[model samples]
Target: MVGTAARALIVSERRITGLSQVVIADLVAELGPVWQARRDAELCDRPRRRAVGAGAKYKLVFVDRLLATLVHLRHGITHDVLACWFGVDRSTITRAIGEIRPLLAGRGCRIAPGLRLRTLADVIAHLGATGQTGIIDATEIRVRRPAAHRRGRNRFVSGKSRTNAMKALVVTDDRGRLLFCGEVRAGSVADITQARDAGLVDLLADTVHLEILADAGYQGLAAQTYGQVVTPPRKRRGKNLEQVQWLMAHHEQARFEHSSRRIPVEHGIAHLKNWRALARHHGHRHHLPDTIRAVAGLLSDQQATHKRKLAALPTGQSR
Candidate 1:
């Protein structure tokens, strides 16, 4: 007889890990060999007969250990609960996460898009080769408020979100494939500032054309420098939007069209937040960049796999 927690973790992966069985199996195939190698090296480094309680041996198999850590990440489940489910001590779950988190993050970096825009030409060529038109936006993740005595703590308060949050600039292709997630910044930082700091505005007008789709929050940002910056028309302080449009020959309908086009990036951001860690972060804030990168890569791989499976189907059938 299997326990409820065990059944949830091992049998219904999507319930506990937020990933389908097929994807989990694929991940094991990809990460199993490296994990085994590391485990073997650690075992070799240990004494033949260790001191009592210096280290307790792991009870679960390699696959279960990996699955346990992933479930913790996806569901933000407590270690004590995980220990009960896996029939291991709480410390074992902690050790597993300590070892596996970095591996998963490293795997994420491999699939993430590179953003080395050394020159304007590089920006143009990179975007052209990877994707032509893309959306740029900022997302803020909520975090526990730091104590008042903590230095530089005030920087994390975001007026926009009205909470203590960390912000990141996210860029994605028209298809919603994540291109890059900028380094985490204090939520007080503006979206345009994040983009400029991340070199999204490094392109020169005289060079190749780069179309960047952005929301109204990023108005008047390198409008002349970058090939083009598409943003919605902003209303003047004293005038209504309709009046401003009528007086300035601006069409409000165009703004609606622009927003319609930017929806995919919004969906991408929502997809990244599905892992729950981003929903409410309780860990070290510094680890967020790695976590975001890892999730993006996993999503990209999952999407690719879905496409491949769809392609294999017969012409008359639908997935």
Candidate 2:
């Protein structure tokens, strides 16, 4: 049963991983060596009494392990379900994901060969170098409510979504390609607070030419970044009726233009949420950061592949 399902799914890679066969093959080729080295290092550090190959081998091979992890991340399948699919115990599926997930997260968001943006600094530098305008936004993912006795339980409740959730800041290029997905925060954390805590102001301060387009949630950032952070215009209060009406007209136009520029970030967030694991995290809250970043990295890889194919197409041919 496991063999049949696995073979069928492998033939149709997009169903499981939301990635093409070519992309999966490229990932396996690139990540296999690094995973092997890391495993070797772990074995050496522990100095197992049994020689190499003395213990029972993995029930799922490296490729299967990677595939299983991707499927779980993309679809949020339970470990027991994955175990049934792969013909292994639930513990095996759990261990496999624990191992492979970090590798994906560590890869960050790859834009080109030998260029991966892992941190906010890396994203800032890339945008500056490429002269691409970036769009920034925060999105929330609903999660299981915390127990009454839990410390900081209220922190998980979002004022905006009015649900127990976690939030992450997403940054994307002008064309809606993911550049960075910030660390996860409590749902109660304000978008502006998260941006400031992530050092967006300090980082963008040095990059004179790079501008970040954001929505109204990041209002104060424009002043702090010296106009580098562009946001929708705010209406002036306590003005005469004539003055207020004029300001309102001006603000409406400015807002429309700002929203158009900032729309890419919404698309970026939508793409990130397409991963079931991110749609609503059922796992421990502490693990959400790794899960979100890993999903972002995989999505970025898929986007990069699509872009390359488009570039390769003949003139006027659209995919």
Best by TM-score: 2
- Top candidate by lDDT: 2
* Clash count for each candidate, listed in order shown: 0, 0
Give lDDT tens digits, candidate 1, residues 1-319. 2255665557465666766777778778878899988877877787768643457555776677778777777778878988887787888887877777777766542222233232324434567666578688889999888987999888999989789999877777787866665467889999878777765555434445667789988887746555377788665442687776574554566777889999989998998798787778887787777666566656666666676678899998978
Q: Candidate 2: give its CA RMSD in angstroms.
A: 1.8
Give a tens-digit lDDT track for model 2, residues 170-253.
989999999999678899999999999999989987888678888888999988999999887777774698988888888889
Task: Give Cα distance to truth, residue 145, candidate 1, Å.
Answer: 1.2
Where is model 1 more than 4 Å wrong at Cα?
1-12, 38-57, 109-126, 203-207, 235-249
**Model-by-model lDDT, in order?**
0.72, 0.88
